[model samples]
Target: MTVIGWIQAIVFFLLVLALTKPIGSYMFRVFDGQKTWLSPLLRPVERLIYRIGGVREDEEMTWYAYAFAMLAFSVVSFAYLYVLLRTQKWLPFNPQHFDNMTPDLAFNTAISFTTNTNWQFYSGENALSYLSQMAGLAWHNFVSAGVGIAIAVAVVRGVARTSVKTLGNFWVDLTRCCLYVLLPISIVVGLYFVAAGMPQNLHAYQDAVSIEGFKQTLTGGPMASQEVIKELGTNGGGFVNANSASPNENPTALTNLVELVLIFLLGAGLTYTYGKMVKDTRQGWAIFTAMAILFFAGFMLAYWAEAQGNPLVHAMGVAGGNMEGKECRFGISASALFATVTTDTSCGAVNSWHDSFMPLGGLVPLVNMQLGEIVFGGVGSGLYGMIVFVVLTVFIAGLMVGRTPEYLGKKIERREVQFAILAALVTPVLCLVPTAVAAIIPPGLATLNNGGPHGFSEILYAFTSTNANNGSAFGGLGPNLFYNIVTGTNMMFGRFAVAIPALALAGALAGKTSVPEGPGTFTTHSGIFVALLIGVIVIVGALTFLPADSLGPIVEHLLLLQGNTY
Candidate 1:
């Protein structure tokens, strides 16, 4: 709305754009088994890991083998975290003396972090010990994100190589990703955060009297370290309940800017990495262009809606933008931008509450997730998710032009198309179906804190967030057993159902020999393709979720115009 706000948004975006190629190129080298600057230091550590685990770094895997390894690792991770959560009372670093989680809550929390969803049914400071926060949740954050990057690398390899039965070794890709990329960046960022006033310690909570004479318990633990990877890994599990909104987690404007940059950095850079692996950097830019277009459009709409504030508040003689649920330090523009960026990817760490936004403003975040979060989505998930739409876009283009669809030289045949459609369909089915069930059921409605359309939006947003593997919430819903079990199920299916099919598509593509481009072949890296890709992504999302959205935010917006409150 204001010039300064616009400048902030522009500068943030330019920073991301400037760093895309450097990060992308580095990631490419790291995954391609080429030496990097860090190899001298981390190479020994990386080799030691493989040796201790008895993993054969040189051995490649078929797509099925890769998926199996991923699934097996996730299962072990889920069980390990589940046990940790259920037994945190006995674990080390229990300064707060938190008790163990109940069975269902443990099940939900385990699956949530394991799937990289990080949905919290309970507040962190109240429920979890420091050991669970670090060893259980933060550990999952690193590995889960690494898994996503590995899967994306596999999919890219499928496109880059010709006549190969294998993509790459999942273990190697994951190990290198964590060792070379995530760990180094996280360390540097963690240190910067600590210097910027975020806490990193093992001290007990401090009890203090506020200026208003109220006693307050100040939560403290190993926050800066978890906070670094939380955004950097696109894992949004907060060490504290207030999340990034808390000064302990995200203290200043500089820290906020860093968090925003970290959220989009990997997702955006992966487009370049994709192009590099595919031997065409322009292809990456085209994908980046489409993502940027969607991201900017969403941010503009959110910022505008938040700036307009509430008509009800305007009639009440208030003259400024909606700041009800926003931090005064960041104001409307930054809050809206954070909401848009966090949902734009799967990084759901919010500096403001989406539940308190204008209906249309809240709608922006909802629609972003429902669009499959491919607008510079989660770290590894974004690239593969966009590739899903890319496959569909090329298929539709081929249908229109009366030619076979080909992408990166391989034909997008029935198998690939089917797999793409399967991946694409996962979101709607998981989101909408669970939403419908929750809307009518007593157990679902028992936790309702708002009435009518806004209430409906709460339920809709929960499922949408979970299915998108996004962890932010509407903050009104009191998640119980029914909600916990259902959302956890959706998160698992959302993460794997789409992933398996995507890997299968990559495998199918890898087996095919590259076809020479002909007169009828579609050029995928052009402006036309970018436009078409955007159209397909928007249209598909609109057709699938528009009705559900109408029943939620759209209807609520109309009612608000008539001076009605939910």
Candidate 2:
């Protein structure tokens, strides 16, 4: 709302824009198996991984094979992480000697990370040891993100290629993505985070006394490394439960800026990568522009709402914005920007609690996720998700023009459109159905941290976040056995349900011959197309979620205006 906040938002966006071309180009080369600056260093390592795994890098997979590989990897990852958590007591680097997780919590944590949901039902510092943090959770952070990027790359290939049997090899894309992209960037950012006063040690908890003589035990571990990838990978799991709000996790404004850029870095860049694959950079920029438009609109609303402060506080003669659940170091603008960015990308590492925001302010983040987080979504997930809308947009245009739809010269036929709709509906169905079941069930009602509509908002946000593969919580729900089991199910299907269909869509597109564009072909890279794309995204979101929003945040906002608090 202030000039400074606007300036901050602008600068953050400019940085993301600046990064798109280079990152996009690099990813293009990496996936295309072309040489780059890091080729000499990483090529051997990449080869070694393929060799050890006995994967034939030269062999291509059909869509079915690729989907199988992705699902198989996720299953193995979930199993490994589950075992690690359930048996963490005997693991090394237990410095705190934390007990092992219960069966349900272990299952939830494992699936959460494997799906890139990273919804931490337990506090990281209190519940996990160093080995579990690094070996179990952080390791999943790298591969799950790599998997997402790989899937996106496959979808791009499907759109870009013609009459191809294979999209690309999932294993190769996964390997190279981790080696050539994630690891290098994480190293630089991790070191920088360490230099920024974030912890990068294996030291145990340090007992300390505050000025007021309160005993405080400060936890430290391999945080800097996890912190960067957590943001960079859009894996929002925190080394501690405080997440980005903790000083040790996100120490300085410089680090804050870095984290924000990291969240959008790959997601924004992948738009350009899509353009590059499709041989149309403008196509990528169009998508990027649409994403930016949605991002700024949501951000401005969130910042404005937060800047206006709470009306109840104004009635109490307090002013200067809603700082109730925000860290003093971040203040209003930074916190608002962070919340908006995190939800915008499904990187749910929050600096401020959404539960404490003005209802309208909180509604923005909710809507962002509800819209499928396609406004600079998760690293690879965002582009493919938006591409779903692109298909829908063009299909609608095609229906209007009485012609078959084509995107990137590939026909968007009944099958492709069906897959797109299926992918798009996955989150809404998972989020809403489980949410309804929870609302009426006793165990579900027992998890309410508040009463009335605000309580309903909390439950809604939980399922929405998980179903969107966005792991942010509404900060009141004590998600226990039933909640964890159900949300865990939501996370798994939330991820693969869309992912598998997207790969299938990519396969469908990959096998099709490119149709020649005529005057009647809806140009996808124009202002009109961009407007159409935005309209489709918004209309779908509004239609699918308006009723839920009305019941949750919308009702809560009206109640708050009448000086009522749930």
Clashes of each: 0, 0
Best model per lDDT = 1
Candidate 1 lDDT, tens digit per residue, 266-310? 998899999999999999999999999999999999999999999
Tens digit per residue, CA lDDT, model 2, 192-296: 999999988897899999999999998899999999999999989999988999999988888899999999999998998889999989999999999999999
Computed on alpha carbons, the lDDT of every model, listed in order, comes to 0.93, 0.92
- All candidates: TM-score: 0.99, 0.99
The alpha-carbon lDDT assigned to residue 380 of candidate 2 equals 87
Clashes of 2: 0
Candidate 1 accuracy as TM-score: 0.99
Task: State model 1's lDDT.
Answer: 0.93
lDDT of 2: 0.92
